[model samples]
Target: MLNAIVIGGGLAGSQAAIYLADNNVKVKLYEMRPNKTTGAHTSSDFAEFVCSNSLGAQSVTSASGLLKEEARLLGSKLIEEAYNNRVPSGNSLSIDRWGFSKKITQIIENHPNIEIIREEITQLPKTPTIVATGPLTSDSLCSEIKKLTGEDNFHFFDAVAPIVKKETINFEKAFYASRWDKGNADFINCPLNKDEYENFYNILTTAEKIPLKSFEAKYFEGCMPIEVIASRGFDTLRFGPMKPVGLFDKRTREEHHKNYQFYAVVQLRQDDKQADLYNLVGFQTNLKWGEQKKLINSIPALENAQIVRYGVMHANTFINSPKILNKTLQTKFNPNLFFAGQITGVEGYSESIATGLFAGINMLRHLRGEKLLELEAKCMLGALLEYITFANHKAFQPINSNWGIVEKPQEVEKLKKKSKEEKGALLSNIALEYIKEIRNGYFC
Candidate 1:
């Protein structure tokens, strides 16, 4: 019997272990937590979530939502576990972070075919292994990964977000509405007049930012701090993420006048179902907490805003996927070696789990002497893997699932009058059909 070692017991590692063991492959899972700590993780719990509790949107039309549905149809343990312990957050699948990880740890621990090992792995094993060490991988093991992949092949950065307590928000000043009233309008919009926006921008530009540690490189372009975006120009933020387009001010009872464009708008999206916590949408920052409080509260709606969580940025590490892995998520150099999760350069929890399930299935195929399965591009899972494994390696950065990543079918495109929701529903149906085809073949 072949044995497989899975490093890092986060979502990716745990999912990989479950799949391999289900196929009767002896599997060992290694996690470096209470014994070894990452800057983000707070506990020894396997698959600990260092950020927000919500997985992603749950609607089948959304990329993250569609990915969850796909995982569920394919019998994904993570998906099933998430749904069972779900905490309602309107349309999103938010969870109690502690409850979520504990459940996963229990399931993995109870599985007879898998063994859990708690220790920091500074070097790769001589035997076949899957490295799912996540973005906050330790310094020592990162060095070994760099040596194997070649110097300069890996990238690093601090990607941080602030957290706020749900009770601190001033509900009187903020309004709940999604842009264009398109979806559930679940997000809270903090509207700003031109004066309020410009004043806030002035404070943002001059605010003292936390300096990067000597060992840490500058942030990756994808997750650059909001301050950095502001420094580019006063108008940069307005055009970038803070743009107030698609939103109409309900209080004024008038379409926000075109000439009255906001200097900028700060958006808060629901972080959990209780409406107690909301994330500063597009407000990732490295600002010192005191400075953040001073500057952020300057906004009209936030003058008395109680910040429950402060934003943070930390070093993130990942491997060069296009060079090292194939579409099935197995290493080209070693059929028995598999890679999954954030280390594969797929961003977000949903994306990470999707890759894990794919890696697990492929690992089973190798053990059973069956042909490996590679999903079609029309499917969300297939499109994600194809992008990671085939995109131009030199320009590659970690990616979250989005419409741009998948090509829409001609039938959906032909309907000019179809709303976005209608189009999404059509595409979701197609994806489910594709998944059913794969599942039927495997079981039959």
Candidate 2:
């Protein structure tokens, strides 16, 4: 029987352990929390979401959502737990962080085939192992990784958004609606008139910001703090995250939000299943606590909003994957050692979970003397693996799921002029078909 060691209890680590255990492989899962904690984590729960509680868009036609769907089809325990503990977030799959983590921890602790080791791993494991210690990998283990990867590892700062009590929000000004009504009216939108938006923008751009450590000051483009985004220009945020497109003032019977334009809008998604808390969407920040409260109060309807958590930033480390690991996430120098999660250059919670699944499945395949499986490039998981393992090594950066990385199918290419949604639908169908084939041929 095959046995494996999985390091860390983050999303990726938990996922890898579950996969191995379900496949009859004995797994020793190590989590260095509640014993020796990462400064960012507050609990000893498995798969603690230190950042946003969202898992990104929920449409299979979208890249991020497709990755989640792929994991679900493959029986991802964390994804199942996420759905069970889901919160309202329109077209996104957001979960109650505490409940979500607790559920996974309970299940992992009780698994017969899995052993939970609650201690910090000071060095790399010698046996077959999946090193999924995420971005906040311990310093000593990082040193061991450096010796293998040759010091080409990179680090970037990731910021978290603040969450507020639902009752504290002034509902008179904050209306309920999804971006385009794609899903339920799950988002609480606070609209800003031109003057209101201008005042808020001025204050936000000039707000007191937190200072990052000198060695860990670089920010990832995908997770740029709201203040950093606003610094670009007056309309920078308007065009980027705070754009008022696809949303309208519900107080008026507006025509599909396309006919009218607003200055800006701040959206909050439900942070818990009870609908008692909601997190500011795309409002990740590294501002001082006082400044964060002040900045949030400047927005319409949020003047008395009670913040449940303050936004903070931390360093996320990822290796130059293309140069260090193969498409299967196995290190070139050490075949027994595999990498996953944010550390492998795949960003976002769902992407990290996808990599863990691949690593676990491939590890099982390696032990079974079966050929390793690789999904077609038309699939989200396949595109992500290709990008991380085959992209330009020198210029490689951590990547999130995006259609740009997906390879177009021949049928999709034949279409002369297709809308983005139509193309996405075609690509999604192709990807799912490939996944079905994979399940039947390999997983079955």
Candidate 3:
């Protein structure tokens, strides 16, 4: 049997270890969790979701959905585990955060071929290794990584939204509905009248925020602090996350809503399997804890909202993948060393799991002395790998899976003839076909 080392028990590392162990590899997985803390995490479980529980949409036409589908075709362990612990979120893949991590922790701990190490690995290993330490990497291991790459990792700040007790929300001001009636009423919508929106905006923008001097880093655009987003403009929130389009608050009749339905709306997504907790959608903030509680209380439907967890901001570090990694996710200097997840400059939960899945696959091939497999350029996983490993290293920022990164059909006339959804369907089919073909060859 072959031996492999997996560092970090977060999403990526856990995925890599599970894939390897299932394939008959003797693996040692290292996690520095309860013993060492990353300020963002609140649990000791593997694959813990520290930020939002949602993993984007599940439709194959969507970018993240397609990436997840591709990983599923490739037999991604964490992806399956995610679905097993999923919650109701319309078309999106939201999970019971606690259940998802707990299941993965149990599986990893009990695996026969995998040995769990409850310690931190401060330096890179010379053996077959996959470093999936993720974004919140410890300072000591980061220094060791820097020594190998000779480049400082780019740092960004990620903000998490606050979770509120569901029963505390005032039903009179809030209603259950999904946007455009796309599915059952999976989202808790808090509609705001013009005056109420104005008041909420004023309070949100003026709320005291924690000092940024501690991190001294710029916020990732995808997870910007709500207050920072508010600073952009008064109407930015309305146009962005708080947009009131495609929603009908049944309580307001057409006669009463003759002019407009609502000025803005806030959405809270279900967080746990029991449906007792919901996180403020797109309300990631760095406000002081007291200010966060006050802000939540100010929402019309949340006048007495009980906060289960306050929003927080944390430092994230990622390597410059274009400079240091090959398309196979292997380090340029060491074939035995590969980096996965956010550390490889790919963003989002599905993207992280996809990278780790492929890294584990290539590691198996390396052990067999076979050429590392490069996913087809037309596929979702392939496009992400191509973008990160070949993009301009100096200006590279973390990226999520999007159609723009994937290879597009060359026939201009065909594309012009199709609607947006039609185009997405065509692209998805192409990507899936490629991934399915790999399935037979790699796993059979």
Q: Which of the two candidates, 1 or 3, achieves a greater lDDT against the reference? A: 3
Best by lDDT, which number? 3
Clashing pairs for predicted structure model 3, backbone only: none
**What's the true lDDT of residue 378 in model 2?**
80
Residue runs of model 1 more than 4 Å from their true location after superposition: 22-25, 85-90, 182-185, 213-222, 248-263, 391-394, 407-426
lDDT by residue for model 1 (54-137), tens:
678899998889988888888788888888777645577867667778988888889988988988999888676888888888
* C-alpha lDDT values of all predictions: 0.79, 0.88, 0.90
Q: Per-residue lDDT for 332-434 in model 3, tens only?
A: 9999999999989898899999999999999989887889988767999999999999856568898999988888877523688778678888899989998
TM-score of each: 0.87, 0.96, 0.97
Ranking by lDDT: 3, 2, 1
Which residue pairs collide, candidate 2?
Answer: none
